[model samples]
Target: MFQGWNALLASVWGCCLIGFTWGQLSDSPDVLRNWCLDSDYHKPQPGPEPQLFSECSPWKERSCCNATVSKLIHHNVKVWHGFQFRHCPPQVSSECLRFFRRDFCFYECSPNLGPWVEFEYARKSRQQRFRNVPLCASECEAWFHACKDDLTCVRNWGSEFDWIEGTNRCPENAKCQLIRDTYADAKDFCETVWDNDFKYTPDNEPCMVLSFDPSSGNPNDNVTEAAISRHMNSINSMLNRQRIMERSFSCRISPSIAVSRGIPKLVCDFSFREFDKMRQLKGKPKETPRQKKERKQDFSPENQHKALRVALPIFVGFWVLIGIFIYLNTRPKH
Candidate 1:
């Protein structure tokens, strides 16, 4: 029993280190790494796992999830976090549902989401989210074709659904319609269904596919690494160009804008090359690259506070872990 507690205490300390490391990562442009969400289901870090189950098997060589979660999400469960597929009368088709399962497997298991990882500001707890992930055009087409005949009432599955008794139900104002009727095209379906989590792309350029044959290769690995490299080169080029003046972005929130829809937007002119790809998504017009120079703010006070919030808990936890370890080992035992 004491030995088990020792391992548990050690794990808590490791989580503390991860918290501090991630806080530092936000301030440092040179460091990016494969990361998993701080979720109850995810492992601390991504690594090789050879025995993942069913549709999730393709990620077995490198995954953020274990076989237990893969099996649970595939077999023993049909709903997660109050979301379910049986919102319409005819219900979702098996093939269509399988496509969704594969997508979930990718989201929960693949560590390649690093380049697009962002924070879920809406959640009180710290959680990582993927933003504007570019999906291979073929997979989007395939998913849409399979599900077109199925029924749904909402465009955005992430936040538009209504839940009752812990399962999703169509909103009171919504009437079920065919998936094709709900979304204009595969691109629209991919982009809006998850509220911009995925950006559909027609280009043959390296993009992520939800499911792949392991015998061939995992394109996700190549795609994210390439994006990171491209992003680094872009950053280095910008710094070299601005070495004398050090240009950076300064965004301001336009809180007084009347007739604003939903959340307020932050307005800014600064831009980066890799971020340009996402501008092409959802019919958003791309802004011309600007060369105006502004002083780069490295670790502002607000960032310092954020770092402190992350670090304070870690510091307390480390001492607490040490205390527990010492108590267990030094205390008299029968």
Candidate 2:
């Protein structure tokens, strides 16, 4: 009776454990899909800095195993807010600039305003591949004329604001329309905003003189200039980062190819290869049916002996328990 009871308990436990394992194996596909979706679909964020190459130089176009290359390729990096406004190609309507201004400007552009920019992803393929396309110059000009004096247009234009409230305050329909349509309108606004002031501002302007005076040996002036230089460099770095992000999102698989068009030296020479190596270290390859069978057969002979070596102690303990139970039951009345 004791032997039978011990056998029944072992059998029940074994059956339940096997069933659970099989259920998990069958649901593997769903698990994998969920995992991929979680890991791949979201906005890319800044990751750990890649290994830097000492041999690489900014002036010289050469390749080294820098981790920044992968981040740039994947568009998982950040830059200065001011970089977007730099190097505007006159009369050329840039889709990159347009999209960048529309979506990212509120966060990165002006600090004084609130969120008011109304932007949507362009559906057309030509617009998506916007390089230096022509924009609505006439509409842009007309809109700029009306809003040139309005505080919101001049001060809070590129910054941020409530769309409904701000639009209502605009003096003219054209001003509201251009401001809402950010791409071409933004370019025209930026161009004309400072145009009138540039000619009137004399060389001896107090603010300009203190900042640009070469002979000023004052320590404060030197410090200010150095700070300005660093700020400019940061903006330049952000510009490069922006280019890579745009290209990566635009062409997910082969972003390097698209980005390399403008930046000849930034060809992803080793980033992908390094990324693959990193993946292989962390990722396991799925086994084929034949491979699974081979793995199962590995339990024969020496493997069986190895298994017995481990199971022998557990088996001994089980029989000891059964023997004690039988002894306890059969003992004389006490």
Candidate 3:
């Protein structure tokens, strides 16, 4: 009888867990779409960080790290992963240090790292990480050139740094060397640091920025949404805890993502056609499957200009049709 009772309780617990997982997946594709990483570090959701440090301010509009974390990141007093930038000769120059700080800013603060987030299978602490995020060639070249003359003891900051006394020190018998000499070239420099966390993309392409002019609108936002939209479409089928394919970063994330799971994604602006379809759905009684699918596929804002172009015509035509119908109905038995 005790065995039977235990079995029943286990079954009930499993079902409840499964229900919770499905609930997260069934949420609005838009809300379910954008998220931060699930770790000791990130916030439950990305929101305004108005008080973020000036160096990390570019992400203030939407950030994973709060003001406290931003402040921590800016201070050299906070030792990260046992790293010491001064582990080599001729100390990291201010220009080169700025580049490193910007890189950390993006990793620690930006909500835009969504597309590349993945689980680390072999990691002992098992923190999820973003992989192969694209960096603009110009930025990569600039980073490389800025630090080329500076010295670092290791080629891969992720794996090779030898931690000691709560900070990194040069490995045994390893000599310090110039950054340019440490890496083969600009592409090699970008890819090899931190074990291929970044890939170089040429200018005018849809690469991300470590820093940007936020006033003009963020180019990376479009890239993130497009990738998320693709992930959403593929997840249409029910995913039980076992089958793993790709992403997410809130409690909104699933059991599968709790393990090593990820997917890279596409980049483009949201589309206006989707905006039109969404508008039409307001107050509708029901929708056909085709309509539902169309709505799902239309991730928002393909282009800001395009949305305005499409929406304005619909607004004008609706008024024009109303005028014509009113005129005909009022005509003398026409």
User: What TM-score, computed on C-alpha atoms, does each candidate reach?
Assistant: 0.63, 0.21, 0.59
Model 2 over residues 1-334: C-alpha lDDT tens digits? 3334435545664575455343122122222111110112111222122242221111011112133432332242122212222221122134333332222311111111111111124321111111111223443344344433222322333223223421312223323223334434545453333222111122232111111111332222222243334444654565454444333333434555545545332344333344445446878745768999999889779899999999999999999999999999999995
Candidate 2 wrongly placed segments (more than 4 Å):
1-277, 285-294, 300-317, 329-333
Candidate 1, residue 321: the lDDT equals 100
Clashing pairs in 1: none
Model 3 agreement with the true structure over 156-200: per-residue lDDT tens digits: 888887767766778898888999899998999998888988888
**Model 1 vs. true fold: TM:** 0.63
Instruction: For candidate 3, give the lDDT of residue 279.
Output: 43
Best by lDDT: 1
Winner of 2 and 3 under TM-score = 3
For residues 1-334, write the lDDT of model 1, one tens digit per residue.
Answer: 3334435545664575456345223422333457677666788778887889889999888789899889877874457555678778765688998998898899889877777777777643337677788899998999999999999999998788876787788889898899999999999999999889899976588788998898887878788777777766755654443321111111112323211422223222232332343345547654433422212233667777898999999999999999999999999989
Query: By the lDDT metric, which is better: model 1 or model 2?
Result: 1
Model 1, C-alpha of 200: deviation from truth (Å): 0.6
lDDT order of candidates, top first:
1, 3, 2
